[model samples]
Target: MIEQSRLVTPVLGFAGFSGSGKTTLLEAVIPHLKSSGLRVGLMKHSHHDIEPDKPTKDSYRLRYAGSDQLLLATSKRHMLFFEYRDNEERDPQLRECLAQLDHSRLDIVLVEGFRNETLPKIEIHRPSYVKPTLFPHDPHIIAVAYDQKPDALDEFNLPSLDLNQPSDIAGFIKHWLANAPESEKYLAYELKL
Candidate 1:
């Protein structure tokens, strides 16, 4: 999927079953990534309908009143709400979400779901979950980060990460970014000059 025409900026995914600590790892590593002078963008997928604006808020009322798209801009931040049409009830495509980001402003993009997509990802695993690992089935998985090394590791020869060390994971990510292939580094927008 990296070679696909839509690729814009380097993308790394954190994938695992629910309760595998994907969010926890990201929360811890994002600070390290930012501190190292990297601008990161994230695309997270949700199984449920999200109501970011409260029903009591004017924005929410306006959306329900027939506005298809609403942008709420404040001094500190801006939020956009897109009210999907009735016929558009479906999971968003990964490419569609990637296009929503301003690639020019981000050094890399971290995807939080879309585990079935063909992309390079770090598998977050917790042995206690008793869930089978994804790497054996997904060739796109480049490494495994775990709180405890799974017994299956003996059969797979992949890099193992200490889930407890966010700094180490950050370092690993930085290294991967530095060495990522040109095909995977396609940018959505390029400076002509």
Candidate 2:
């Protein structure tokens, strides 16, 4: 069989400072999105390193022994592990990683981090915090989700939604994906407009 190319998945993100409800909102919205028949893929960035295989495990031993890449498979599922030989190898290009997903099988890719990337994002703002709002500075930020309307809410005039209500956020995402102008500019592969 021929290898399949990655899908040109539409991408969006939840951008917020720490302690904001980005993750919690996503957890709630996912079920709502799935209920509507959307196939969603997610990528959450972790500040620390993650080790899925333990040192005692055979896969880990094999990886340390010599293998550059390993795949553990069973009828239920398969996991591919790649070893980066150099400690310097970190933070790979986000687009290259996104391209690895089968985007054709997904309606959206809900990314949790890489907030600085150029993809369109929905800013999560809690009015209690004094920090600068991301929407004022980031053109890629298309909307703001807030717990309570902030003093500067009228400045940008961008669309606003209640962060406490995941259903409303889900509705916005569904509609945004369906009607976003020149949507392909934010796909896994940039489209020729």
TM-score of each: 0.89, 0.85
Tens digits of per-residue lDDT, candidate 2, 1-193, equal 3334333667898898877778988999999999999999888876777789899999989999989889988899777776788878488567766765666678889988788888889898887876578887888888899988877768988889998889999999999988887553365343222
What is candidate 1's TM-score against the reference?
A: 0.89
CA lDDT, every model vs. true structure = 0.85, 0.81
What range of 10 consecutive residues in model 1 has the weakest lDDT sum?
184-193
Worst 10 residues of 2 by lDDT: 184-193
Q: Model 1 over residues 21-76: C-alpha lDDT tens digits?
A: 99989999999999999999988888987888789999889999999888898999
**lDDT leader:** 1
Off by over 4 Å in 1: 1-7, 185-193
Residue ranges of candidate 2 with Cα displaced over 4 Å: 1-7, 188-193
Per model, state how many residue pairs clash: 0, 2
